[model samples]
Target: MSSFGAIMVSFPGAAHRQFGKQIYTTLIPFGVMERFLMVDDDVQRKLNKRRVKSIANYILMGIKDGNLCFLSAITATCRGPIQYNEATNQLSIDISTQMSVNDGQHRFAGVKMALDTMRRKVDTSQGQQRLEYSEKLKKLEDMAIPVVIFGNLTKVMEQQLFHDLNLLANKPTKSVSLKFDNSDLYNAMAKELKNENEWLIRFGIETERTSLSERNRELMVLSTLRNMISFIISGTDKDSNAVLTLENYNTWKTDVSELIDKLFSVLPEDCNDRSRYIIGLAATIQGIGKYINYLINKENLSDEKLSGLKKVDWKHTNPHWNGAGGTFDPVKERIVFGGTGGGVNGIYMKLIEINGPSI
Candidate 1:
């Protein structure tokens, strides 16, 4: 039995001292875990509800019968140190001691919510549905998560531990992260497009997960494609808080892919080089994504307008782009004048204007 300040809570687990710290490990059940945990806001930031809800959705809606999921061990501590009996492999906390979480707060909250939701489903459901939900509830109740507990520490020590846990970790680059994450719908779509589209191959696709180098051969990166699809879905180049969706993912996929194909077709053979055409630049593709969204979402895009790209002069020599978004530099092989923010907006407007009459 557990909850902060409850009667003595005991469980079979193990503990050992590491670098002057006593650490404990255990597999905790969801029902017991929900009541067993607490948090000190002073040591951790306020919970992000959106993040918690995202995790909850993964738990409830994840595509599987067994609902296979994984979470790293939660890091935590008791208000007072826990005692362990090596012979029995039993761990116990004294009365009034509290189990507080230092990390994995979001996962903890999500699991608790999923457990509560399943219980409600079982209670309210009728007949076969109730039986089905009860089965699910049993499985959920049986779910156990690995947890790591630090020996009792003061508030200052907790703050330091939290800081080290968050700040010391290095995150993977955006491109690589998206490439490896098949769970995200957008990333999955991007991978499928990359393999199926020949246009991506001819111009080259960047898989190294870095910005294109001066002599780089790639026209676009995986992350860029993933973001482009997101932009197209949201129909905005600016940051948007609204959720994005596509009526049929393929319809927009074909439209945007055709738009890109046509735009690239109009350019000269030398257009693949970033130095030869501002259109070859990554920022230009970003702008194109916004424009494509605008065309579909605002202008009621048609076949003729897409085909009209054959008429636009996309060369860097075009005066429309010179002062508006900086100039092309042959020596550096990069944009010379306009910076990133100003440059993206410039390219976006230029795209609309370049195809204005026909559009």
Candidate 2:
């Protein structure tokens, strides 16, 4: 009992492939995965709490709806020896020593957390609801993901494997991700607003780029619009429920489109070029979002509140933004806009101050 004896934990695969000299591919159940995964702290970096939470939430959402969630295979290495029965296509790993997971610790942790959450929920439910939850729990417990196991690797080898696994992998741009995602209603509604409204169509929105270039004619990026819409609708910066109803989508689209039109009406109209004014800057967009979020409950937009839009110096090189939206790089000969940080907040605070009580 003190030490886990040499009894092997068997991982059965439908079929197995050996890659290079020692890598073996296999499948592992969620049940067995939680117990055996050990992170070698010396070789791996610390687990990210946010990433773990996001993964857990995604799995839980899929499980609740009885849908399949997709993820890449997790990597693990044999500490000493791996018993491979070629005839049975099974991998036997010993639990006597610490066999560390070289990659995907956050994913493992997320799955574990999701299971724990279901267990807790199952304990509290009643009758048919309880039965449904129990079934979901069982389904989750039985689910398996492919695992890539390596013949005993040294610390250096594990480190190198980690590097190789993540080296060239790149996440898509935020705008592109929002454009393709059908999960959240906010992104969909934002896209709808852009497509339906004539003003927005003329203003131009970047569907792929993260930031607009100085010479770029587009005012806002799709991802930035998604974020602003998320804030406006949910009053926070988190993904809302996956609401796919056409009615709700249309309703929100109209309301948001009207609000955006109200903003353009208030700001100075640049006829020749939409990008000539500061109104379309990402920071300004977010600032306007924050201001509009405060007016969400109001039925009417009075002339008094929007008077500040006219007071603002809407030029691209206005001196007011020197240390506010961004600092001026004298030698670089350009204004460096702050990114996803204090710049947006600075603009919001200035808006609130200037838009105060119809002065």
Best by TM-score: 2
Alpha-carbon RMSD, each predicted model:
4.9, 4.6
Q: Which stretches of candidate 2 lie over 4 Å from their true place?
A: 1-19, 66-69, 85-88, 94-99, 239-250, 265-275, 298-313, 317-336
lDDT of 2 by residue, 132-224 (tens): 889989988998877877777878988988887777578789888888876566777778778878777887778988877667766689877
**Model 1, which residues run further than 4 Å from truth?**
1-14, 63-69, 85-96, 109-144, 208-210, 233-263, 267-270, 297-303, 322-346
Superposed by TM-score, candidate 1 places the C-alpha of residue 8 at a distance from the truth, in angstroms, of 4.6
Lowest summed lDDT window (length 10), candidate 2: 271-280
Worst 10 residues of 1 by lDDT: 237-246
Using all chains and alpha carbons, the TM-scores for the candidates as numbered come to 0.75, 0.80
Error in Å for residue 27 of model 2: 2.4
How high is the lDDT of residue 344 in model 1?
A: 62
Highest lDDT scorer: 1
Give the per-residue Cα lDDT of candidate 2 at 356: 66
